[model samples]
Target: MLPSPLAAAAPPLPPQSSDEDFFSTASTSTSSDSKPRSPPPTLPQIPIVWPEAGALTASWVADLMQAFEWASKALPPSEFPSVLPVAVFDKLVLTASKILHKEPNCVRIDENSELNSDCRVVVVGDVHGQLHDVLFLLRDAGFPADDRFFVFNGDYVDRGAWGLEVFLLLLAWKVLMPHRVFLLRGNHESKYCTSVYGFEKEVLVKYGDNGKHVYRKCLGCFEGLPLASIIAGQVYTAHGGLFRGTIITPSKRSKKKNRKVVHNPKVDSLILGSFEELAKARRSVLDPPWEGQNLIPGDILWSDPSMTPGLSPNIERGIGLLYGPDCTEEFLKKFNLKLIIRSHEGPDARDKRPDLGGMNVGYTIDHIVESGKLITLFSAPDYPQFQATEERYKNKGAYIVLEPPNFDTPMFHSFEAVTPRPKVNPYYDFEDVIDSDEELDLVSMVTDSGLQQPAV
Candidate 1:
């Protein structure tokens, strides 16, 4: 049975759209020989209603999910979907981006409010496409409501064959229930990652010539996604783990004494970054190169916690920091938080870093410090959806339910991947996929794609 949250204080449902027509069907054409060609695939759509006209019905959203699932399973790789009259996709993306842009880098969800008294907040990890599993997850955890909120810790696209479907569905929910659904930006959300990962290729395959426009809109939406979220003043959630504290490092100096030259560098003093700093940080960069003081957004979206003490660079990923337990304790104590929940690793990363557990169960309490616990959650089961016989991780997916009043302890729900997922080919070449720590030659990637270099 699906788990139920405390009684929800859901607001009155909005009036449904009046129009009965919803499906935007594809047309099949015939050759002069009279042999019918296969019908081109089409994106999922509901009654095209303006935001002011009325909110989309729950039934409409449900239908959209079903439509996406069906298409992913039935459509062939050679056939690209028609996304013309692109306004339909544009409307949802632009509207959701506007809402997300206005949100602070760290969105705060306070507890003890009239609406949150009995409600619960569901925290989900990376869902790199995998639409069928997402559908199963929603059904398992219950949909977002006024009381039951959802904080999706990024990585919504890439890897799986149905990223476009997964992303659009989440955006639809965000537009319909903005307050209840908080979508944080994962490192994969950036342009560089998408260009290297399968998302960009997936969009091009799914939308044909109009794919560029749709992909551009997705980049805009990615820039608007928040970096982190604070739940009920107790839990801290980000796609990656801890962010770096402000620091002042002295420059190197040389001193000559007794005809000998000596070079000395002053030690660096660290000051943990505050919520105020996080709120003030600029996070709208389409792609953060993780350079200079501008690295706050990178840190938030890419950093990971370590067993060692204090903060150091996340050398493994080539960006962000590998903050130790001391860092976690200090950050939690300073902010009065009880736990840190983040998601980015999968079975692949786990194999390399076993200190964080096998990830076979999908969630790991990486660090249990005196101040609180730092948990790592991965919601995509059997991650890296298309894998060779030797590459399968066979891991379960999981989500966390945080109950209110205190909202400290997290109830973990783990599930296996949906069976018989649509058989589809990977859009990207296997050689293009690289290790997490490796950097892609972006200029070459863009040049090969016949597109100009994106602005740094």
Candidate 2:
């Protein structure tokens, strides 16, 4: 059976106290329809605050101040940059504002579904819409129609100019084999990133207003995606790392009993819904106030892969955040899992360094590390165009294959395989090269069978 939807819903709180109201009295005033009302008077623009010398060069400072001034005068108050405190450096504020504009604070993933017993799995790294590379990897890995299940591990769009095409192909494949194929939400799947990075605008450019239809379809796919999955009772796979306040417990009752859980109360209420419920809970904890201390185990869905081991000292006490290995052992002991397979980190990470020697593999962009207890994989072989370098491998592209456990052999088979390329050099004509009648006949026999004859 396909996974079910999460039961969490926005709560209907009692009427708010007067101070808590979001709608102001001014906003409620309705002008008479008989005559159109005049536009409201513009407020005085705030002067640009310049940074002190040594902090920012005069030219750089002037340019930013000019830009801010221009924006203040041209844009509406709601669109203006928030005023920074005098004590904060103007240059810092300007830099931060630019970063914020590029990378939105919040990301949204729509939803997705998958069959329950499709246990054997292989998750591809980020595709970034590299059509040839994606197809090559799938073909080489024996995917799409293989008995083994597959997860795209988020990042199906953006970076590559071909996000739409890539997503459409995946959508078609999903329809063909809904039970075996799954797409999970990635940080790049957000509206903020899509708006700036080209996926959203690309669709608009390609489909016009109908572009929104495409966007909605993609968002729906994202929203319905399972945040993470446990396969063959041993692995947990998602786009990113675990959130700060998350704790993994054996039972749903324990998750509820934990007082530190501060995500949407609705999510806590729906703990028993399905694996998708765990995903919704992850979204809430990883939202705004991300730096806030109350994260829970479900929050791991949104956490970024970190090189640092052990609990972050900056994190609050009493919250049960554990290393990937600790998490692996705990899950193994409690749920009878033999290992933990995760894909947030790259498959080629420097050393198999999970805090507790857990198997981990990092297989995509940046680095890929494959350890015994934890493994990181990436489906997008190329680095995102907007970001750093692409992943390096002897093979043209990559994917993983998992088999049932055996006492004589390890539980999983994970590695990169090199693909031979066609020879580019011209063949040589040598007088002594198999000129005998028997040898010539043998060459002719090989060529007749569609095999390449030895170069002469």
lDDT of 2 by residue, 1-456 (tens): 112111121112243234312111111111121111111112232433444542433233223323332332344323323322222323342333233233211222111223233434556655664443454444344444434566676667765545655665555445445556666556556554455346776565545545566566555444444455555545555555444333334455574565463332322231111233243343422221222222333244333333454333212111223243443343345544443334433322222334322222324222222322444455544233223223332222345555444211122323322111111111112223321111123334344445443211
Q: How many pairs of residues collide in model 1?
A: 0
lDDT of 2: 0.39
Residue-level lDDT for 76 in candidate 1: 66
Worst 10 residues of 1 by lDDT: 21-30
What lDDT would each prediction earn against the true structure?
A: 0.72, 0.39
Candidate 1 local lDDT, 1-456, one digit each (tens): 223321132222233322221111211111121122112223345333344554655654655665565556555643434322356677778878888999888888884333376788889999899887787677667787666789999999988888888998898888878888899999889887888778999988777788898899999889899999999989999988776545433335433333321111112433457776677677877665434445678778877777778777666666666888888899899989999999988877877875668788789998888999999999888777876343567888888989868788998888777655656788666555664423446456456546554221
The TM-score of predicted model 2 comes to 0.48
How far out, in Å, is residue 103 in model 1? 1.0
Instruction: Give RMSD (Å) of candidate 1 vs. truth.
Output: 10.7
TM for candidate 1 is 0.81
Root-mean-square deviation per candidate = 10.7, 25.9
TM-score of each: 0.81, 0.48
